[model samples]
Target: MAAELMRETWSGEVSVVTIGAAKSEGGTRSAMVKIGGQKTLPFLFAEGAIPHKPVIALEIWDIAPLDWPEESTKPYGQSIKDPLAWAQMCVKEFKAQLLCVRLQGAHPDFGNKSAQQEAEFIKALLKKVDVPLIIKGCGDDEKDNQVLAVCAEAAKGERCLIGSAVQDNYKTLVAAVLADGHNIIAESPIDINIAKQLNILISDMGLPLERIVIDPTIGALGYGLEYAYSIMERARLAALSGDKTVASPFICFIGQEAWRAKEAKVGSADQGIMWEVVTACALIQAGGDILVMRHPKAVEKVNKYIEELFIPR
Candidate 1:
């Protein structure tokens, strides 16, 4: 006889919250992407519901990545030398629906480009790709505030997703986003409580609940991944069980985590590439709505997992 199914009955409820805007909807994308609507645990297809398939976003940076390992860059080649060309390839070749370009050179030490400089680079990338764009900072609180606010105004009406608003700079960032009119990715450093707090802080800034996206930070497998999974799972549970603050769409910085960790994507052939795939699949299984990953293998593996788990009603 076939083994009994391991799935158990679940009882929960969650509001449907969609992120991103379309060109017709006033953004510059062909279609808007939506995530975060669950009535039960991850992929309880019979019980829980998935409104939109999880989205994959390819990450790029403004300047040539001086720090990326050769293995990853070898695949990118001369394309990496030009940000616009790189963004073009990520969307055209990789079929990435979202293009996230981090302003790495804008950091105080690294070129310290002003808001106008960031805006020009962003506009250039925007012209290169038709997909929705996500702009991130170099994690400097004060500089992030100054640049992001100006960026918000510069990208106005296009409805780009401006991000990484943390607690210390939430007031300035949130107010600017509100006035300039754009969506946000509220950021927290791998803590559930901190994640919820950032969401609340943004909401308190008068930003509507639907326009917010949460990034709780990620640590790849064998590098505090267990903690990330537990925290993500718990957040999903709370959101589905009707905790409004935790219901926002969650985004994961998969590349940052997977590449930095020694286990899978970084090590030698003896290290086994399968581990990286497993690590990525584990994150999808752990309730990640959007996996912002760099390696094509990781995206392929995660895409397969989503395909297997999503069964029609």
Candidate 2:
């Protein structure tokens, strides 16, 4: 007799959130990307469903990223100076499915560029690329509100995901994203309770649960990565147990955190590459639905891993 197979069942599933709007949906993009809607863990195809493939979003900055380590910036060549070119290269050359435009220039500590300048830059970038975008702020609450509000209007109806809204500074960004018809990323430190609470706060503002993606702040390998992994695992389990407050899709800033680690910053090529790849792989297994990565090679490896995991046996 054949051996019996055992499987676990889940009552709740991750919420499905669509990021871009096509022409038929009143937006100019050629396509759209849908994430989440999984009935099982990362890849347990035999047990449940994996409705959408997790996506890789290449991160690009509005201004030249002089602080970026040479290992990370070496791939982009001259496109670093031009946001449009860099975005195009990511989609065309690197075959990135999505692009994340980080508005670092607007930060007071950075260039301190005006919100209007940032808005125009977004408009120009939207015209240059047809792929969906994730508009990130410069980590400054006050400036993010100003810059993102204008960007929300500039990219109106594009259906971009705008955020990094934390428990304390989410009001202004949340209000603007709601008004502009864009999705929001509810960012929280690597704590399950805080993660759930932030989601509650955002939803209480009248934003539908389907329009939010929870970002439990990522911590790279050897740098509290295990803590992040456990938090995500627990959060996923909570969501699976039918907790609506924690059921939204998860997004990890993998590249940002991974590169911040000393091993990835100054180590040899082998160590740097492996560090990023390992960090990203762990996060994927831990239940990351969207990964914002920096290195093209690391992205390639993670994409390959995702493909293999999603393949039915």
Model 1: worst 10 consecutive residues (lDDT sum) = 264-273
Residues 68-97 of candidate 2: C-alpha lDDT, one tens digit per residue: 778888899988898889999999999988
- Can you write out model 1's per-residue Cα lDDT over 75-189, one digit (the tens) per residue? 5679998989888888777788787778888898888999889878776766677887778887888888888888777776666677888876788878877886777888888
TM-score of 2: 0.97
Error of 1 at 138 (Å): 1.0
The local lDDT score (0 to 100) that residue 61 gets in candidate 2 is: 97
Q: Let me know the TM-score candidate 1 reaches against the reference structure.
A: 0.90
Q: Provide the overall lDDT of each model, using Cα atoms, as 2-decimal numbers.
A: 0.75, 0.90
| Candidate 2, residue 34: lDDT | 97
